[model samples]
Target chain A: MTSHPHPAPTEAGALPGSLLIRNLRKEYRAGQPVLKDISLAVEGRGITAIIGPSGTGKSTLIRCINRLVDPTSGEIWFGGSDLARLRGRSLRMARRRIGMVFQEYNLVERLSVIENVLCGRLGYVPAWRAFLRRFPDSDVERAFALLDAVGLGADFATRRADQLSGGQRQRVGIARAVMQDPALVLADEPTSSLDPKTSVEIMELMAALSAGGGTPIVINIHNVDLARRFAQRVIGMSRGEVVFDGPPDALEDRHLTDIYGGEGWLS
Target chain B: MSEAALSGPSRRWVRFTPVERGARALVYVLTAVAVIWSLRTIEIIPEFLYDAPEQTADLFVRMWPFDWAFYPKAVHAALIETLHTATLGTLLALVLAIPFSFLAARNFTRSGPLNWIAQFVFVSSRSVNSLIWALLFVAIFGPGPLAGTLAIAFRSIGFVGKLFGEALEEAQQGPIEALTAAGAPRSMILVKGYWPQVEPAFWSVALLRWDINIRESAVLGLVGAGGIGVALDAALNNLYWDQVGLILAVIFAVVIATEFVTSFIRSRIL
Candidate 1:
């Protein structure tokens, strides 16, 4: 598939979001913890890459923001509410402004590409209408535009997500997330399954999304080089704690050795 | 080539361990003993087998001389009754099973005691034969078409609920989670995420059971629960072999018709 590289999202006004996490903690077992007393704030605008070795707390931290994996103890302040304490309708409303992308693409395999993209509006639309596929004309048109903006042609709209290549599926995933008109986008290992070239393409697409709008992205990634190439700010984690936090240029071999604990893999 | 491979079939290279061989021998011996014991207990005799063909031939001879005229009114009404019993029973069972299956499905219910109760209902319904269910319903409801319809519905809950429950459990979890993250309501999750995935399977199970119910309900009249089987029972009691043959023929035709309709619908829709 050729890259069309259409223009950025311009229809929906960009409402950049701010997030502040205070003393976030998650313990799966009684004593052992996956994330420990971590605090970080993402102001707005630009991609914030979280690079760490496998089994670290990078994924946990990202998931906690959306309350997918509830934090053991913390305050998640986003859009004038504590995301940790919200329940039921309030939680859902808070989540509508926050969009998330997964490692697996996670599009409903049986649904067509257009329907999957329109799923982003499920929070706003009434249940009956959504179930009946009676999405408003404006929503449908915007979904098509989002698909087009992601370099997928109009023909791809009717195709099933499973029929596409890995790269194409990721494109749909991006389209779905942006379709939410989100303030914050959380991505968990979005490119770990793709080839090197496709990985770069995914990163480029995400970067353009962050740049065009003021939406901030916290991507948990393992590819350090890709993170450096794409991320404006990089936060490195080791043993469930952030060991280094700085701009990409400020990060060095010493910090890599500290975060990953290796000298041989750097060269 | 090795000597073993060249001398024998390739399968010779694979051998059962001594424990496996011993278990196999023990199983064979036990099965042989059990079969012999059961045959003796049931009083199997060579004399019955010798007379079987003769008796069948006598009955077959008596069933000749087509009673086609008897089927015009009496047999036709009974056949329609049987169809009604089956169709209404299936609709009732399908409606009842939808909620029970949710309780039984691991993903939907998630409650240990409720799941156990749902499983219990399914098992009990399935364990009783349709004839036995008709007998029970007749005792409670006083031997009418009402009894027959209720019997069919109760008997089918197990079949429909168990299949539909398994369908719910087999649905893909990824889309479910995606819907949850999008903050869709619980009902919406079911409507959009789960229903589409399981719609074809639900229809297939219901159609199969409807075809079977047609056959089962045709005989419920033996217990005076109503339907064409009542006509069948009356014929058999008076030793009216020709009338019996007519009823049997009508039942055979109806069953085949129902099978054709269900399969055609299944093929077209699914």
Candidate 2:
């Protein structure tokens, strides 16, 4: 295990999961680009939040990094491979190293929480083993540990996923993502479906867990206050373009107005 | 009511337009004409119609004393054979239909040709009745329980496969997306994501088809495919109304018993 207890190197050093995206463009329809040209680099550690109005391509940008929503044209360099170009087995290998959390918890509702968390190890284990639910003992132990780390105790492990409330389900979601032992974790509006108090709690839990594991997070978030509070670095976006990229302190009301458009709601 | 009174131009609301009313009246007239035409065309002999009640009474009188002694000699073995045929056929249908169901489900297999082929198989299998299937199988397998079992199985594939495929198609996309993002292989996604969602529906559909297959296979023996229907056919040919009445009663009791058993199992399992 290369995971260190200390914080990752701050400088643009060779941290294992440092992502460098170059001129990424995506178009779902011919000549109608959803993401016009995006370029940014994320550090290997710390929470980097991308804030934007709905439909401004925050999801497109985050999904592009893992090649989930494939970029029409661009290069995403991470761990010595272009993620946009990888296909089949190689693509799966790259994806297994990056964990993602969704706005909806997205748990297999019929499965037990422990089994859902063990799904993270699917890419690493053989298909037959997974089919039989005969995961390695160490993987099972780690899954339990991750559930505990995500604020769910061992008692919750055997319960069906659908039995949990929204907050509890997201906790299971986070545990599942963390169970992958990812180098980078991407969260696409991870707290939108949550109530305000639970959203803050989830962000806090995510911040604590990822920081301790030295795993970097690139989260697409709509709640600007939550973003500023938890994100070390914030990238503000408008019309599929990044308008501001800096420390959270540098994100003034004017920048929020520019990113979200209009000062009507700022009051 | 106040708003309408204030408006003063109270309009009426009609359910159907003039054209729609005309169309409905035309449908009624056509249906009446069709009934009259069929009644006029049907060639019913007046003498047979007049004696129908007496003939029915005479038939019942002949069948008054059922051949209960036949149960130990023949009906019991035939009844057991019928059940085995139904059970084995249902199991076989489940085994064969599962793969076709996967192929037919649009979400599971994305290829158009595969879906079309699976649907084609289902349609052809369902179009032919089980008795016809028994006839075809009896010719191939030469008069036995094997023919009866195969007949039931072949007839059930379409019903079981179509429903199972629809169940697989209805699985939520959210869980599937999560598994895919986790870098799970396609096979793993099917096993972990889709299978859990569809398991209950699979069993429910299998049980339902099995229940229907029991009724179908009971009559397959009339085609020389082997079941209680063989005894029924022999009694009818030999003009033994009492034995025929006994077989019918036994079949009725067994059908009711199976219905209870399947419903109980379904409730418990689901």
Candidate 3:
């Protein structure tokens, strides 16, 4: 059964949660590909920020891993299965292990904050249990703890999600993602709508919390400064292709200009 | 404070284009000519305006005050029956509409053929008038409260179903996406995500439909389906103007009472 050269069993790629994307492509409309043969790998730990200018396919690349935006052609290997080819039940199960946080903090407005946190458990809980809202005691306790960890007090449990400010909502968003105990996390422009201070605070919280459990997070970030600050590894994309992939220290002005294009804004 | 010095407009600017002026003149002339022609075609008699006041006065003289004695004999029971018919009918429609609406809502019901069938059912139910439905049901069930109840339910299905489908369609996609990413099954998505979003609309639509059903049921008895209209029809047939007046007054009171009650419920629930 062993066909390829062995890279020692202890190699990072042998780990169950390792994410490897190969030749991924997405064409929202025919003849106009948004993700063009992008390939990368993460060893399934720590934060890796994908930075690019607007409309440079950063969000699309993140979404494709979750199968939220279907990849036109490629292989997304994670958790011992090809994510791109999954359908229905298989797709949902895979998505469960890959948590996502949206830019807008898409909490169900009518739901209480605790319920929104419990939403991350829907994949594990039975349909009837979810409908009855009879979450397991452990999941409920975990959800409460997660709320506290995200800086919302346990008293905020019963409050409606819409009652929170932008920063608080993003905290809940992170809490919701981590509540899944996910193998990997994807955050699409997680701080684009946030103020400068709040943006850094969220990035810090995301890095600390996600790294605590050794869950790898792939965030689509527009702010290059925050990416440089929090990300251990950085990916720079331009015109649907990865132009730079290296550690944060190696990301130079030349790369920024190459990724973002002739930036007078860099001044 | 300087009213005399202020003016409406200056003559230097041309307002309406010549083409617009011609089009407006054509519209005005055509509308006036059409109204006059329609009056002639319908054989309108201006003389009725002269005699209308006397006829109305004489009719009022005949109707005079309420027929207090007749209220107990026929009006009260019929009014109660009308209320029962509407309540039961609206409940039945709601039960049927919930599943039917899921089928008709395009975003939920992905199959083209199934959606077509659901839409056809809604259209067919809505196309027929409640009175016509009453007439059909009366022919089948033999002129009773059952006919009136069935008539009201069948007629309301389209209205409630269409509104419900629209409400589901217009639900915020973001929460639903969140649920989907959480691995919620389709039914859980409906109960937790979609239902909460459309709950206010559902309540409002149901109450409004119930209010409409009440009015429809009252007059359904004209086609031999039992209601307040039956008592009024009988009195009219017998040339008893006072009893007819009494029944009309009861229907009016009942309608106004229900309007107040439904509006109160809507306010509280929504």
Number of the top-ranking candidate, with TM-score as the measure: 2
Structure candidate 1, residue pairs in collision: none
Per-residue alpha-carbon lDDT of candidate 2 for residues B8-116, written as tens digits (9 for 90 to 100): 8778999999999999999999999999999889978999999999999998888769999998999999999999999999999999999999999999899999999
Q: Per-residue CA lDDT of candidate 3, range B1-270, in tens?
A: 576557645547678999999999999999999999988899757799789999888877767776889988888898999999999999999998889899988888899998888889899999999999999999999998999999999999999999999999898888888777766678878887898899899999999999999999989888899989899889889878888778888888889999999999998987
lDDT string, candidate 1, B29-111, tens digits: 99999999998899867898889999999887888875888988688888888889998999999999889998999997889
Compose the digit string of candidate 1's lDDT tens values, residues A98-213. 88888888888878999989988888899888978999999999999999999999999999887999999989988988888889999999999899999999999999999987
Native RMSD of candidate 1 (Å): 7.3
Q: Largest lDDT belongs to which candidate?
A: 2
Minimum summed lDDT over a 10-residue window in model 3 chain B is located at B3-12
Question: By DockQ, who's the top model here?
Answer: 2
Which should have the higher DockQ, number 1 or number 2? 2
How does residue A113 of candidate 2 score in lDDT? Answer: 97
Q: Candidate 3: misplaced stretches above 4 Å?
A: A1-13, B1-21, B45-49, B111-113
The CAPRI classification for model 2 reads as medium
Q: Interface RMSD, all models, one decimal each?
A: 1.3, 0.8, 1.1
CA RMSD for every model?
7.3, 4.5, 4.7
Task: For model 3, state the Cα shift of residue B237 in Å.
Answer: 1.3
